[model samples]
Target: MSASLSVGARDLPRTAARRVADGLALAAAPTFALMAILVGAGGSDVGQMLCAGEQGLQIGGMTVMYMLMSVFHLTPWLRLIQSGKREAA
Candidate 1:
């Protein structure tokens, strides 16, 4: 009916936003995984150049930065998973 149609119309934007977030989350997992691998494999030269100006952090600041960024980007995935769990329950 018109009310259901109206409800669907209102949900359009929210659905689109969820799609976007899901897409980003999909990309983020692989991206952070690759970055973690590269960093763990001693690929922080680029990161060091960008962050430490050739001096570099004695404690691997670049790796820490990437770790923080990866965690930050994990929000969407976490929310998606929680929502899925709730729906399942």
Candidate 2:
């Protein structure tokens, strides 16, 4: 009975988190598209942006930074998922 009651209590928070996730997912596409359009319009030698002597590469910097930041952003969701799996077991 308590477990079922707790499940009912969990639904509101889960629904709120789902809404936040949906919002971020929805926002991602337009943000990416705008960035792509701006980058495309501002034409440079995109190839040379990541060459042997081009300070390692513009893209390389962005990739490094994104990965570094993603760890912090993704860790919470990973823990949440793991906990859900544990609960199922």
| C-alpha TM-scores of all predictions | 0.53, 0.41
* Candidate with the greatest lDDT versus the true structure: 1
Q: List the residue pairs that clash in candidate 1.
A: none
Off by over 4 Å in 1: 1-21, 44-59
Error of 1 at 40 (Å): 2.2
For model 2, how does the per-residue alpha-carbon lDDT over 1-89 read when each residue is reduced to its tens digit? 99999998999899999989866755554555455444444434656545634542234444444444544455456666798999999
lDDT of 1 by residue, 1-89 (tens): 99999999999999999989779777886687567656755655677666776643333666667777788788777887899999999
Query: Could you tell me the TM-score of candidate 2?
Result: 0.41
Model 2: residue 23 alpha-carbon error in angstroms: 0.6
lDDT of each structure?
A: 0.74, 0.59
Worst 10 residues of 2 by lDDT: 52-61
Cand. 1 Cα-lDDT = 0.74
lDDT minimum window of 10 residues, candidate 1: 54-63
